[model samples]
Target: MSAAAPYAALSPDVVLAAVDAAGSWSDGRLLALNSYENRVFQVGLEDGGVVVAKFYRPGRWSDAAIAEEHAFAIELAAAELPMVAPLVIDGQTLLRHEGYRYALYPRRGGRAPSLESRDQLEWLGRLLARIHAVGSRERFVARTTLDRATMIQAPMRAALGSDLLPAHLFDAYRHAAGRVDDAVAQRFEAVGPVRQLRLHGDCHPGNVLWTDAGPHFVDLDDARTGPAVQDLWMLAGDEPMMDALLEGYGQFRDFDPGELALIPALRAMRQVHYAGWIAERWHDPAFPAAFPFAAEARWWEQHIADLHEIADDLF
Candidate 1:
């Protein structure tokens, strides 16, 4: 078994046992949830109620960092923002059982928001503005910051160091990555003095759920300190969508138009980081099964070409 199969020992019996130990009565029902980085389950209680149990990936985050994530979710919920906070068991949101850290959340469900709709985009913008308002009120001392070093350079190094990139394509990948790095730095320098605040670091559409009431955000697992634009850009796919989002966002808080310049740079960083992330986790069994595309030399060729295009945009 590979080192990445840390959860191999975590069977359905163990999931039910862990939930039971956490003071929730389980009737031996467990359904695995779709997650790659961590193990999550929809556990059914004896009373017919269901709650989501999330087992944090071993060694991915420190206890302090997880606590910060939980705190941020709670803070957002307290402010009446549509965020799902963890269920507190015995006055603590985080719980440990048999050396595994876990948390339980009341199950909430909604469909993906239609970003194509201007009204929906504006509504999402308002919610994000409110979330950012609370995020600005404090700092995450233990969490990471989304910056060039962490998001770009670190991932680039991981990719360059890894054996996953075919030896023949390594030079091409490195050259394109270098250009991307240089361009990203120049863009950031151009957008000088952007404000940094705690944010839903991975605020893409998958993290949001929409219903008749409104949109609710889930999974603060990637929450960290960064420019507010990090939360907004992922939701806006085009110019009109961005304009609509900003229009609603401006209603709650003042937005700096300068941050708009960071979009291309941010997009480039995400592309590089995503590839690196998959490479870093390839040792894990789930990655290979889920991202079979990464195994192809042709994929790397296209990826390098895409990076070059991002560099062009940045230039």
Candidate 2:
């Protein structure tokens, strides 16, 4: 696992000062919190209450991205949608400290639910529908939806046309890229209107929290306006995964043939990206259970094979 450098330095004084400057907390004690890509700390105040401070990784994201997410969360909440709203500090939703932008949030209660319950799956679908409903009102970001070619081509392109991926992946990427148009077009026509809504770009099971109220969504860092199918695509699985979710989601929203058509390819894209990321981070002990090494490697292998088989049919 290649983790980035830790934030400049984390301490109670630094955290308290940041929160105090925000006017939300007068005086608070800070406790270090755990995070994968960002720095999190639990700030305890004189009144014995706590707030979570999330500081973004310096090189990982830009200030604009952070602010957009914070604003989007408030928008969602105002629209009666599920989101982790961020606290304003120093006249900015994101606080700049130690060369990193941060946000403070009152900790909410929730846990990941076991997949055994149908109701839970239904809740996931309904909550996702509500997220889509509110996000579509405005253009949150440009080019929210990513076509298959862009996924396979962009990184390679950035690598200066010098395929840095392993040999095995080269073939898979090439195969997918060659016929990207047909697959994307098929999906667009089937799914209808591209279903572009401001979306939680990474709304997998792990991002969802089964709170006392219902399924309360957290982790809006990857939130963006994009194809709504992208959310369902990330939840791809055998019958248990799709059956209830599709049924439940349908109750809140309907998908045209175009959106439905893109489901499979989009699902494949999600799995491909996830598998690649997990494979890269396989050595990290903290990589979530969902991306366990053995299972992920197996999935990646199968995905490569699937890519090979689907190559000709994509177009």
Candidate number achieving the greatest lDDT relative to the actual structure: 1
- On TM-score, the candidate that comes out on top is 1
Worst 10 residues of 1 by lDDT: 1-10
The list of candidate 1 runs beyond 4 A from truth reads: none
Model 2 lDDT per residue over 157-253, tens place: 4322332345555565555544543565565565556656777888777777777788777788767656776777666565677667777787877
Cα lDDT, all candidates = 0.91, 0.63
Cα deviation in Å at residue 34, candidate 1?
Answer: 1.5
lDDT for 8 in candidate 2 is 36
Against the hidden reference, what TM-scores do the models get?
A: 0.97, 0.73
Residue by residue across 1-315, what tens digits does model 1's lDDT show? 136687877889888988898889999888998999999999999999999999998888899999999999999999999999999999998898877889999999899999999999989888889999999999999999998787888888888888888889999999999999999999999889898999999999999999888889999999989999999999988999999999999889989999998999989999999999888888888899999999899999999999999999889
